[model samples]
Target: MGNKLFAAICYGENGKKILTVKCEPEFGIYLRENYSDITLGYYMNKVHWNSFDLNGNVPEMIIKDMIEQSINWY
Candidate 1:
């Protein structure tokens, strides 16, 4: 990606895999509303980042889409 967007992966206190990605706050709002597992970025800025379970019920393709979309947000 040409943009310098920040992204990362880290484990939470519960030992679950978390994927953090940079994204538009508006889009993050949409995802948070539609996906039950999405949360305001874990230990990150809520408006610029989002974090979700790598193995949760949000579906595999959607997660992949999110990851791809995130890298392009900036």
Candidate 2:
């Protein structure tokens, strides 16, 4: 068997997902313009999702705060 990957998803009252722990499009664009390791989310809505290279230049605290903000959106 092969390994599997899962995402931490946040859902709305309507049972629709508001955001995943992944990055958002607006932030992604800003990060990409300023950092080298930030990119659009794979297998996700490009206009609303983003992926981050944890080993890259972004600070850990910033990432944490971003995730928190996403959660608060729900």
Candidate 3:
């Protein structure tokens, strides 16, 4: 296997992890289904995590929203 490429980490109140989100799961899934640049989390629970290609076609607003959601969800 190779090294995982994660954009950010989401931690819980006690500093435990909630998920490693590349983008919000729903949007990530849509990107996965509709595009070739997004994928499920490299080493995380696929249902709740996703890995996005930052060099891909995703928008800045969406990326910001995803990061916010990741933090909010925790």
Best by lDDT: 1
Residue ranges of candidate 3 with Cα displaced over 4 Å: 1-27
What are the TM-scores, per candidate, against the unseen true structure?
0.83, 0.56, 0.57
Q: Residue 36 of model 1: what lDDT?
A: 94
lDDT of 3: 0.60
> What is the RMSD, in Å, between candidate 3 and the native fold over all Cα?
10.9
Q: Write the per-residue lDDT of candidate 1 for residues 34-63, one digit (tens) a residue.
A: 999989899898888899988878888778
**Span of 10 residues, lowest total lDDT, candidate 1:** 1-10
**CA shift of 42, model 3, Å:** 1.2
Candidate ranking (lDDT, best to worst): 1, 3, 2
- Which candidate, 1 or 2, would have the higher lDDT against the true structure? 1
Which ten contiguous residues of candidate 2 have the minimum total lDDT? 1-10
Model 3: pairs clashing at backbone N, Cα or C within 3 Å? none
Task: Quote the lDDT for 63 in model 1.
Answer: 82
RMSD of 1: 1.9
